[model samples]
Target: MTPSPESVTTMLYQHDDNGALLRTDLPFPRRSGKVRDVYDLGDNLLIVSTDRISAFDFILPSGIPDKGRILTQTSAFWFDHLDVRHHLLSTEVPEALSAQFDTEPLVGRVMVTEKASVIPFECVVRGYLEGSGLIEYQQTGEICGNRLPPGLKQCDRLPEAIFTPATKAEEGDHDENVSIGRMIADLGSDLALGLRKRSLDIYRKACQYAESRGILIADTKFEFGKVGDEVVLIDEVLTPDSSRFWAADDYQPGQAQPSFDKQFVREWLSTCGWDKKSDPPALPPEIIQRTKAKYEEAKKRLTQSEPTL
Candidate 1:
């Protein structure tokens, strides 16, 4: 059975006094993404998942407590469950860098991974019609340049999962969906075809597992990178931040479904009366608690484990 949110302990990193860690000043060279900070360590990279959350292109002022650890743990679970080759080397902080900060906060929130030449695409697969796909389909009867059968409504399950790849955007920009032909033009047919097949296979395997756990994977995005000559999975996999996870018991075909992802945060942001052009306001305490519950619930349900009380 799934565990209650309160069962998990709130252990904050000493440096994370604000409940959200906005940045890390590690001694090594690093680059920051939406939610992760990647540090270069020659052959390997250290990725630190922060409690920081972003919505509608703005990183909100407030952060959810324990959000980083939950995301890291969820990704680690998938990396272990899937049989495919991936970039994770160890979740352990290298002994070499132990003096950088309080290692306690880093535990369960950092990964030491093999560095690769990352592919520049968001390999997305959709099992249900929703999100940008729904918007595109409503307008063009197509998504990612592929036409589907007529009359599909929002959140309707597609006859089959579809591979719709998008180009990865720079920080603070939106990712733009591109056609297979465009992918071939940019990445060549052989590589594009390989990514498509690998993405669909992984999605199917994950979907089956999630369904058994009472979660529906509506859609998800994946990142890949080249280690030497082979393309291997890189970055986080199948976590709530990268996937749309709906509760199987509450799923409805014609309306937006309740989710175990940041949809809750996004929904609240959409209706909060803030203009998209200005800085996003800090999330209210209620929103933060509710959002954190969803992430924790997703992790517990998928792993089929009780919280570490």
Candidate 2:
């Protein structure tokens, strides 16, 4: 189940006492996305991942019940797990700010990151045949640059994970997948190579480990920023926001399988008659609850524990 766009928006304002999402009379710096409310705090960016859910690029009416928290906490988990000390600077986040602003307002979904100019690329890594990859395969017989084995069905795993890079666009703009060469042309060749190499490494490592844990990392997106010659991962990693996660136990590949992601929201939109261009339809309460649970389940499955409320 997924939420109606209206209902989802309605659900976001409510938060538990654990922390409150901080709002200000002074508006946040205005880089808007489908779900995140971003604030620029000097050298740090206060990122509040909201419960809002999007399907087909349209923000659905119903929010994924408690999705914001799951995304926030899940991102934190990955930040800590990777432990590379690159973009995340939660510790440096003002405790005073944390105390004054309602953290539970945003739940554990808020992050204070060292502000770096975001790389203009969406570092995509694919380890299976599905979604965009499947479409590309059926239409062109190639995904990114790799050819697939014959008889592969939807949701089928690939022989190996591959790095698929694309350009990150502004709100309402679609991210375009370009070859490494184009990436080099836009962002110097050296940087492009680094992004490609690192994107693949992260995906390879994360997917391999996730497989060991009974989760299939079908695909995931990564963002990077440079902190003096060091290429560090940025933005959200492995969440339903940026990745497609599948249950390892239920592995069947002929058609779309149940996923701990936005499957419901996507399905509902297909029947809504709303073109993917305009605002999407609101999800029913049942869909909202299911979508919310899907988020929590993904976080739980990945972290092996309940997220901090």
After superposition on all C-alphas, the RMSD of every candidate to the true structure, in Å, is: 6.4, 6.1
Give the alpha carbon lDDT tens digit for every residue of 217-272 in model 1: 99999999999998999999999999999999999899989999787788888898
All candidates' lDDT scores? 0.87, 0.73
Task: Write candidate 2's Cα lDDT for 117-169 as tens digits.
Answer: 67888888888888888898898777777777777889888888877788887
- Candidate 1 accuracy as TM-score: 0.93
- TM-score, candidate 2, is 0.86
lDDT of 2 at 16: 27
Name the runs in model 2 displaced over 4 angstroms.
Answer: 1-28, 83-85, 91-93, 98-103, 273-278, 307-309
Model 1 CA lDDT for position 306: 60
